[model samples]
Target: MLLASYKAIRPGMQGIANRLIRWRLDGDYSHNEVVFEPGDGVDHLMPDGTCEPDASGALWCASSVAWERLPATSPRRPGHRGGVRFKRIKLDPAHWDLVKYRRDPLAAAQHFKRREGALYDWQLILGFVAWLFRHKASRDTCSEVCTEAGGQLEGHRVDPCTLHQIVAAEDRHFRSLLWLAAAGEEAAY
Candidate 1:
């Protein structure tokens, strides 16, 4: 299946609001994986599927599977407060496609740059192959990682310590940012 990105959000096919795109990726291929991102239509669903937000939001649309197949947690942990909906994630794509797509160095490099930088959590990047993008032992570890931006995701590697440093730096920066936001009486997402 070809996964395409949609500009607007919608209720997942299974009737749940896809608050985020959940991508479960393994090292070998991305087809079976999931990606999570901020979702729309969050206002339509309530803590218990009743009541409405001040206004309804957009919905998520992925070229992947049916929305109902996505995961969900009830009450999202009590307090009867706001409901936390979907997340958009990145997953591995098919391998032949990976190579074919990788041919475009400009695109591949851009994809790698996005992931290599601080935007991704250190554990997420260093352990990329272990989770959503784990490559089978038969496959080369480099295949699991890509040095290119369009996410060639093959025959590439990064030092684990470097990944940790990136994560730590990001954590500190985020914490400081949060503190500043709180001090100003506004929240940052």
Candidate 2:
């Protein structure tokens, strides 16, 4: 229902919605959850579970965080509707990165184009970090992964390098995911 509602409100923001769902969790490595205000959303589907009108929501799901947290249902807060609310959400880790993958297609297709700088950059980084678990080698093998799309691996605050977490690891991991999409265009043949 969240995805459907998201698609309805702003078809383009579906990617954002996907990440928002992933953000409902909290744990060690990363706390990626969205605490919703009562009636704000996410509870419309499970009106029975939540008596709070503006409940703060959180999404504590992922590979690394799985270490400490349990499924959202078992250990969820008292006000929460438990996993029954998200029972249908696809918990597969592969899909976990789908939000990251759709960034470019949605952008290149020109679906969502607004805002700039850190917020924009973090959108990409969050998605990339969602699935980016590798050595800091995105720079050497990939050019688009650099900050500003194409330039020397100079001093930049964010980029694939940052999210990839290396000396050159800028906070622009989000762009790196978009770069991945741009590069994929070549392989379409």
Candidate 3:
């Protein structure tokens, strides 16, 4: 069965925030997404129009950028102009029924739908400096959406890197799921 996965984006702008995340995490991923379902005909991770349904039959994805359902293909952020890398996660099927496993992607999708049109939590960018001052706004961030959907981040502020690290740590079976889908390059598994 396909489980929720995360994608790291490398916007071409190389903005200071993106660079800082990369430097702090020591990785190139600046943003993350929770895969609601896998794409058909194409690689499951390829941002195409095909999102397969789970046993629960949910079609929506918890996307901060899209007002409705997440597109089959990744939507370009207003200012981001870089390639996206899909992290190839492999979850042991035995863990699917666990309470921890059941709460993500699907829950996140529902949450996003409830908060549709909510502004992106730009204040999260200052998460590092204002680590102690929790944000009380009713908004979301790319990573925050994934973490919440995954039922991982327990109200703590985190960037894309921290989100990735938490997921990896929580799921010891998680592989270093890194599949580079750079522009013009066929995704390599």
Give the Cα-based TM-score of candidate 3 against the true structure: 0.50
Clashing pairs in 3: 12-81, 12-82, 47-73, 48-72, 49-72, 88-177, 104-149, 104-150
* Residue 88 lDDT in candidate 2: 24
Model 2 alpha-carbon drift over 4 Å, by segment = 1-30, 44-48, 51-64, 71-189
* Candidate 1, residue 157: how far the Cα is off, in Å: 7.3
Ranking 2 against 3 by lDDT, winner: 3
Residues 1-189, model 2: lDDT tens digits: 011111112145544544453353221112121122233333422324441433333331111111122233332332332111122233234332212221122221111011111111233334445655332321111111222222233322332212223322232575687799989997896
lDDT of 2 at 116: 10
Q: Which candidate is the best by lDDT?
A: 3
Kindly list the per-residue Cα lDDT of model 3 for residues 1-189, writing each as its tens digit: 122333333346445556666677676456555555452222333333345543455433343531223232433332332222222223333312111233434355445445444556655556655676455456676666666656565533666666666565655543322222342265342
After superposition, candidate 3 runs with Cα above 4 Å error: 1-17, 38-50, 53-61, 65-105, 130-134, 153-156, 173-189
lDDT for 163 (candidate 3) = 63
Model 2 lDDT, residue 162, Cα: 29
Which lDDT tens digits does candidate 1 get at residues 34-139?
1111332222322233222223332221111221232243222222222122223332222122111213333432332232211112233335535555423222
TM-score top scorer? 3
